[model samples]
Target: MNENEAGERQIDIMVCGAGYVGLATAVAIKQARPSLDVVLADAAPDGVWKKDGRASAIAAAACAMLQRLGVWDELEEGAQPITEMIVTDSRASDPIRPVYLTFSGEVEPGQPFAHMLMNRDLNGALRRRCDELGIEIHQGTPIAGLDRSGACAVATAKDNRRFSARLVIAADGARSRLRDWAGIRTVSWQYGQSGIVCTVAHERPHNGRAEEHFLPAGPFATLPLPGNRSSIVWTERTADAERLVNSDPFLFETELETRFGRHLGAITVESKPRAWPLGLTLARAFVTHRLALAGDAAHGIHPIAGQGLNMGFKDVAALAEVIVEADRLGLDFGQEDVLEDYQRWRRFDTVRMGATTDILNRLFSNDIAPIRLIRDIGLGIVDRMPGLKRDFIAQAAGKGGPMPRLLRGEAI
Candidate 1:
């Protein structure tokens, strides 16, 4: 890694937080402009992502972007395709949970809407690409502060080391320190709910079908993983979530069985159950001065639609395009106009998705008879209308609206 010393440091871009978005952004930019100097840093030490047992749904468009970055071929086999999805609303003892809506997951020939893969696999691939691109990584280091008063932004590390760059990308998590340091405010709220995530081993295969059961408390999703295992995202009241997460294994499995059903035969938890607070967090502005926010730093929405990570990937694609173009044009990449282009391109989509997920969570997380009837009827209508369903499928596949060149598998 190149520190470049304090008074003479020169770098094109400095990306804070080595999470999925940070690494991807660094790799994408360096690959597009080999002469540019890029550096990625994270607070956590190296090999920390290996301990993350969670998985995510990578949408088709995100897959294409990864392929363009030379990371997808390594991820292809480790990913389990989601060929179909079914939604239902009912109680545990209702005899049957009527499927209100169903979707055929192909966005095109041989392309599925999404796939389930472990977080480590995705991060590892991006890290390898970063190495291949000669991008420097500052592991176990955090950007303590940013000094933007000079011609170039100077990021001061916790260890008192500094790196000067024309642009700074904050890919930190939802509670981003860089965002706060930049004087950026956010619109945020908690859902009074929590999502309990865990992986399960089953006797029978899920057959690439994902199921969502909207019970009184919240939505319960069984997403198909590779082999006869499936990943569970069960939403519940925050208090109840605490109890289940801290309860004995036997009690946990008992409650899980009630909602999981016997269709998959016997099921056992294969990983530790963890609960994450549900919420909506959107930055008031994505760019200010020479700094820009990406990933969860810009928006955090309920995972009901499973678009959180994919949306972050979209931000990566758009920001990379904007920055690369400005650099090639011999313009100031960190200028307000250049940064505004990225903000404009991504803000509308981010706001729309945050609102959509909020509405879905509110409409389905309760058991009011009247509201249930209305939503179920709405779902049925969507199911019966093939054209409407196709539109929705395309939207979920990240095929709707204007796409960045990287998302279309094109080089920036």
Candidate 2:
């Protein structure tokens, strides 16, 4: 650590952001090698992340990654497991898959394909764990700018105070000010649609099944929540979404019921509706000199695949492992070579997942007839072919792809 960034406090690493991605990165870094001094900063007061209506479906791989970082135990109770995944084309007359693809075993034996977790609950749990881990979390401090010099990176807060370090991790968010400060350009496009998310309480249990119902306007995904409540991701044209969200609760529930069907019984809105614009954004570069990017800071994708956070978790695991390994070899963890190792491992995969989600969202979340027929037939074909089903199961399990040990459920 440098003595001063022009006469200010110096730490080994100064993290910018305490969102899930930032916190995960901080915990992974600290857990990988506790000897390294690290600090996390965010403008949010005391790591508080307001609940915005929806929770993510954390892939088993992501759970393993958190486990490797020593944080999964804190998340277990709040997570709802997914035992089965049912995909349907609401346009088709016969929409149900002939056989439900069971990835329960493939996703991680005895665990569900993914665990649904409330955002604020998980964030609080992470904050508690960070506290236990001795991480210096500087809440209410936002980075105003940064300066990178020989063998060190320096960050300045809004008050003009600064800190120097051997490394800097920019996990701020999609609209990252840090990335901009680093002069790293990003490529992104508006999705022209918005995803309306909310929790619904119904008489029937969801039976641990996650359903993705493809509608004419978009895909209405009902992911299971604990007990009789289910989470809804209703995507539609931006105009339509705005109208529905502004509509009264009764009208909203009625619209939902008209689309949600009878499988889940009488549904009641449990929370206010929230809308998130769907889009894709990828950083032109994952690293610039001593600074590294992870999570939404590096890439943002459509949520149709439910892999947004999973992708970020992969980034956390990969970068943490690389830096930790370099430290074990008595090398500077923030050197260009080390940063490149992190980039090389993650860049291509990020691009592929980004493109895949974009295409999937465009294809299924529409009323295009030809594409609809192909997608429906493809689902049926995949259903009939057990070998293909196994392949997909393996893929969704987060296996047969490049992965970090942390994502494999092993400590670094």
**lDDT (tens digit, per residue) of candidate 2 on 43-155:** 37853476445688888788877776666787888789888887777642443434322334344467666889988876776777788889988878788888886668878
TM-score of 2: 0.94
Q: Candidate 2 regions off by >4 Å?
A: 1-5, 50-53, 91-109
lDDT of 2: 0.82
**How many clashes does each candidate structure show, in the order listed?**
0, 0
In model 2, the Cα lDDT at residue 401 comes to 83
lDDT, residue 116, candidate 2: 90
For residue 386, give model 2's deviation from the true position in Å.
1.8
- Clashing pairs in model 2? none
Off by over 4 Å in 1: 1-8
* Candidate 1 local Cα displacement, residue 121, angstroms: 0.4
